[model samples]
Target: MKKTRFHNKYKLIILGVIILLTGCFGLIYFFYRQSPARGEESGDMVAGVSAGALSNTSFIKTYHLRDTTHGYGLFPTKDGGYLVTGDTIAGGGMAAPYPYIVKTDAKGGKVWSRDFSSQSGALGYLSNRHLGRLAVETSDGSFVTASDVIDFVDENLKEIYGDVLLTKLNKNGAQLWSLMLGDHNIDRPRQIWALPNGEVMLLARFLKTGYSSEITDGIPEYSVFIKIDKNGKVQFSKKMEWNATGAERLVDGGFIVLANIAVILPKPAENIVGPEVVPHPLPTMIKLDSDLNIVWAKSMEMIPTEMNSPTSYAGGVMTVGKTIIREAGGDFRVIQAAPDGGFVAFGYDNLILTQGMSSGGAINISDKDVSLRPLVAVKVGANGNYQWAKKLTVNLVSGGSANDFHVVRTADGNFVIMKDVAHDALGVLAAASAVNIGLIKTDADLNPLWVKQYSVERSVEGYGLWPTVDKGVVVAGSMQTTKMHYVMGTSEPYTEAALIKVDVNGDVGGCAAVTTHTGATLEDQSSYLVMQDMKVMGSENLTLKINKKVKEKVNNAKSAARDICKYKKSNVTPIYSLLTSSDGSSPTASGQTVVPSTAKTWAVINYENAKEVAVVGEKNQVIHAELLPILNQVYNSQVKMKDSMASMWLAYVFPRPVTRADVEVIQKNLEGLGYKITGSEGGDLWVSKIGLTLHLEFAIQNSMMGKLEVRF
Candidate 1:
C-alpha cells in the first residue's frame, strides 16, 4: 500500500510540471503574435482615425476584482503573472475598508485575492486600517508594501496624524510582519523606488506639527528620504527644506527631486505707492546623493541677456511683464530618468492674458478663463541645467484641464504618457466632465506620435501605468459610479478601483473602457445663445456722454484718442467726476483696483467698450477724447441689435431636429423680428436676415456648444 501511494504522488507531480510548461509556451506564442517587428515605424492617427497601430491590438480580457477596489500598483511576477495592491471597501455586517493584494495569471484571470485587515486584540490599536500606496516584489518572492493609516487618537491621548506602515507578505499573500513609522505629525510618501541593492527608498513629506519660525517664515513643509532594508528595518532618514512633489532615481545612483519655490521680490520704489508685494514662482530641481545628502540645486532666474530663449535658464522668469505672474500657471509635477542620463519632466503652462493687454502699473486686466492651459514638457541635462521645452496645445471648446501624471518608456526608445483630463467638450458642466484617462504616445525626442483616451459612463482617473513584457500597457486607477436617481433615504457612494489592460497599440479588446471622442463639433458652440433668445429682451442703453466743456479743451478731434490711451504721457489732462454705472460701479475698475488719484496725470476713460476706444495720451489725447463717445454709441447699437436678433433666430431653430412644430415656431418668431423664412433642405432651415443668408442646421445635441454659419 505504501509503494502504491508513493507512485501516485510522483505521477501527480509530473502532470503538474507538464501543465506549467504548456501554459508558459502559450503565453510566449501569444505575445510573439501581438508585437510588431523591430525597426517598424509606429502607427499614426490623422483626424481621429488610427492607421495600423491599434488595428492589430485588441482587448483580450478584463477582470473586475471587487465592488470597491482601488489598484494603485501593478508588478509582473517571475511566473508569468502579476501582483496588484490597493485598498478595498468590502460589504459585511460591519464594513471596514482595508488594503488588498491580488495575484493574477498572464491572461488577467484572478488567482487569489487577499485583504490585509486583521487587527491586534489590544484596545485602541487598529491594524490594516490603511490604503496601500505602493508595492514591489522582493527577491525572495515576497512583497513589501508601503501604506498609510490615519490614527484619530494615539495611545498618549493625543491626535496623531497618518503614519506610513511597511508590511511584508509571503508569496501566498500571508502577512509576515508590519512596521509603522511616524510620530508627532504626518509622514506621507509621495513615491517609492526599489533599489538594485535589495533596499527601498521613499520620497516623503514630513509635515511638522507647528508653523514656521521667524527665520523661515515662508517654508512650512520638509522633503524627506526614508530608506529601509528588505526585512522592513529602517536604515536612515534624511530631510531637506523644500517640499518635493515628484522624484526619480538617476543612472549614477543619485536622485532627482522636482519642486516649486516661491521667491518674494521687492516692489518697485519709483511708483511711490503702498508697499507692494510680488511673488515669483521658480520651478526648481535638486540633486541628491545616494546617502540622501543634497549635491547641488538649480533655480530659474531672469537674467536680462538670455530671456529671448524660452528654454534658456533666464527664460524661466518673465521679467518684462506685470509685477506678478499670477495669471499664467506652470508646475513641474513628474520626472522620468532618460536613457541618455538626462531627465524629462511634464506639467502645464496656463496663459491667462493676451499679449496686447496692459497688465502692469496698478491696473491689471486679465482673462478669467484658465481652460487654455497646455501640457508642458521640460527636458534637463544630467547636471540639472534646462535644455529644451515643448508645449502640447489642446484646442478644445471651452478648454479643460489636461495633465500628465505618469509616464513609461517603450522598448523602441519611445515614451507613453498617461493623463487625466476634464474639459467642456467632453460634457456640459464641471460635474458632468468627470476626468477621463488620456494617453499620448511620443517619440524618443518627446514629439507626440498619437493620442488616445479612455473612459466609462462615470469619471475615471489613472494613477499608475506599467509596460508589460509583451509590449502592452497596464493602467490602474479609481472609478466612480454615479447614481442616476436619488431617494429620500439610503446612502450610496460611487467609488471603485479599476484596472485596464490594453494591447501594445492601446485598444481595449471590446470592453466598456470606451475610447473617448474629443475635439469640438459644430453644434456644441450654439446652444446657450438659443436659450437666451427665448427669454424676454429688455432694451436699455446706458451710455456715458462726456461733457461738451471737456471736448472744447482738446486741440482737435484726433487728439481725443490720446486722453483715452496715453494716460501717462504727461501732456493729457486728468478727467474725473464722470458718471459712474447705474449700480455706482466705477467704469475704470475692470476687476482691478483703482489707481490712486494722486497719480492725477493718468486718466481712465469711463466708456462701456474698451475694445472700441483707441487709447491715445500725450501724443494724441485731444482727438481720442472726441472719438470715445461716438465710438461707444456705435458699439452699443451693434450689441443691442445682436441681442434682439439672437432670440428670434433661436426661437425658430431650437428644440431642433427641425421638427414640423419647431419650424412653425421658428417661422413665426422670424416674421415677428422682420426676417423672411427663405427655404429648407433635408430638414435644415434657412432664413434671410438683411442681406445675409443664415443656415440653421438643426438636430443639435444639448450637451454641446452652440453652432451658427453664414451662407455666402
Candidate 2:
C-alpha cells in the first residue's frame, strides 16, 4: 500500500510538470499575436505572391499620302474619334494642292478622308493652294472648317491672291455648303467657332491700308470678325484695327480676340533715307459683345529693353539709347477659356531687332542680332482686368523661331503648352541640330510641373494639341522622313502627319528612358491698348466639293526610327486574380463561415479601418498557416489570422502608427523573397508572385492598421 501511494504521488508530479509546460506555450503564442511586428523581416512568407500580365492602348501613328501632307488641327469627336485638317498634295503631284480632312478612330485608324480640290474646281482654278487649317464639330453632329483658297493664279500656276473659305460638311463626309470671303486681296481665316444656335463665327486677317496714313509704306493687315448663319449667309461683319492671332467665343455670348497691334515708332532724326516709322508688334486682348461690339482692350506693356546698338526705341518712345532702331516683335498665338469665366493667352515675347549705322552711313543688322525671350502666359479676369502673367523659360535656339506654339487647358484646371525646341533644351543627348516637340505641364497659376520632349531621327513640328479623357494628351504634327524622289535626283526628306499619345506621366511604352526638364517661371507685366471698330461686307456663296480619298498608314512600330519615338504602355494598375475556392467547392458551402455578401474585397485605402473584418479561405488557410509560424519566428511575436469562405484577409494592428520606413521594410522583405512589386501608390503596395497577389494597405493614421489581402 505504501508503494502504490508513492506511485500516485509520482503521477501527480508528472501532471503538474505537463500543465506548467502547456501554460508556457499558450503564453508565448498570446504575446506573439499581440505584439506589433512592424519592420520585421517577412522571410519566405511572400515568396509565392504573383500577379497577371498587364495591357495598354497607347500608339504612335503616321498617315502617308501620295505627296506632302501637313497636320494643322486635331479635335476629339463625340464618338471617341479624332478629326485632322491640313493641306495635302493630291495625285502624287504639287498641281493638286487641296485642303484635306481625315477622320480617325480612337486607335488612330483612318476612317475616311476628304479633299476640296474637286469643289475648288468650280472657281475655274485647276491649280491652286488650298489649306484647311482649323475645323470644329457643331452640336448638330456636323463639321465646319475654315480654310484659305488661292483665288487668282499667275501664268506659272503661282498663287497671286487668297480668299477665306468656310465649308460645312455632314457627319458622313458630304459637303453641305460653302462660302467665300475676300476683298480681291489676301484674306486668310485664322480661327473659327461654332455657335450654339447653328451659326458660326470666323476671324480672318484682311490686307488693308497701313496703320498710319502719313507714313504709308507697308501694307497693314486688319482682323474681321464675321458671323454667318447655317445656310451660308452672313449675319454680321465687324472689322478691327489689329490683326487677330487668336480668338474664342465666351460662354455669355461674347468674344475674346488676341491680336497684335503695330505701334508705329518714329524714326530717329539721324536716319534720313530709312522709313519714317518702324512697326513694333504688341500683344493686345479685346473683349466684344455678341454683336461684335468692343467692350475693353488691354495690351501687354512693353518689356524693359536694353539698347544693344546706339539707338533704342520702344512703344513709340525713345529711351536713353542711341539710334539703336529697336523693333519689338511678338504675338499671342493661342487663347483658351478659363475655369473662372476668365481667359488665358499664351505667346512668346521680347523679339527685338537693333539696327546701327556705320560711319559710312550703311545699315549693319543681321539675323544674329535678334534677341528672343522666353514664352509667356497671361491671365485676365472676366472684366478684362489683368490677373497674372508668367514667363515660361525654355532653352531656345539662337536664330530659330518658336512661332508654332499651342496651348490647351486640361479638365483638371491645369494648362499644357506644346512647342518646338532643340533636343538639348530638354536635356536629351542628340545632334546639335536635332529638334523635338516639347510638352510643358503647368498648374492653374502657370507653374510648370514637368517638361518632356518627344522626337525621332529627324525633326518634329507639333501644330495641334488636345487633352484626352484619361487626363493625358494627344499631339498631332508632322515628322520628317528621308525617301527616294525620282524628280529630285536624290533621296530627300519629306513630312508626314504624325500622331503621338501619352499618359499623364509622359511615359511611353517600350521606351524606358525619358528625358525630363525642370522649367522655371517668372512674373510678367502688361498694360492696355486702344481699340477701334470698323465695318465689312458679307461674302458670296460658292460651290465646293469634298471628294473622298484614301491615305496610307505608316506603321510607326515597324519604322526604323521607332526606337526614337515611343508610345505609352498601360497607365492603370491591374488587378491580378479573383477570389475562388481552392477545393473547387461552392463558395456558399454548408458549415462554411463566409464573409458578408455585400463586402468589397478591393476597397479604397482610407484612413479609417475596415468596418467588417475579412475571413480566410481554404487556399489562404494553407498560406496563413505557413506564414504565421514563420512571421512568429522572425518577429518574435505571435501572428494571428482570420478565416472565411470567400477569401483570405489578415489585419495586423500595430502598437504605434505605421510609418513609411516600416512599410519599406516589409516591401523589401517581400521583394527579397521573390515577390515582385507590381505597383505602389500613396500608402498602398501590390506584391505578386506565381498565382498569388498580396495587397498591403498601410493606414498611417488612426489605428495605424496594416491589412494584407491574399487572393488567388
User: Relative to the true structure, how large is the alpha-carbon lDDT of every model?
Assistant: 0.45, 0.53
Each prediction's total of clashing residue pairs, residues at least 3 apart in sequence or on different chains, is 39, 19
- Tens-digit per-residue lDDT, 587-658, candidate 2: 222122212112111111121222343545577666566455544544345233322344646654322344
Where in model 1 is the C-alpha error above 4 Å? Answer: 1-67, 78-80, 90-96, 117-132, 156-160, 210-218, 262-281, 300-329, 352-369, 395-404, 422-426, 430-433, 481-494, 510-712
Q: Candidate 1 residues 1-712, lDDT tens each? A: 6544543443353334334333332332232222111111122223231323321222322223334555566776777667666665535212444555666665555666665432321111133222236777776677777665553224332234555556666777676666665543455656776765567776666566622232222356666567777766666666566677778787667787776655454543321111222133455666777655666555532111100111111323322211112211234567777656667666643221111111111222122113323355555566665554444533222212333267887654556777665532343355234667776665444544445677554666676677765555677666655532222344554455555666555556545455533221011101010000011111122111100111001011010000101101011121111222222232222123212121100111111112232222342343223323432343332211011122123211111122444445545655666667888653366777665555655433211111122222
Q: Model 2 clash tally?
A: 19
| Cα lDDT for residue 274, candidate 1 | 16
Best by TM-score: 2
C-alpha TM-score for every candidate: 0.55, 0.56
Off by over 4 Å in 2: 1-57, 90-96, 118-132, 152-159, 209-219, 262-281, 303-331, 351-373, 395-400, 424-434, 482-485, 510-514, 519-569, 572-712
Q: How high is the lDDT of residue 390 in model 1?
A: 45
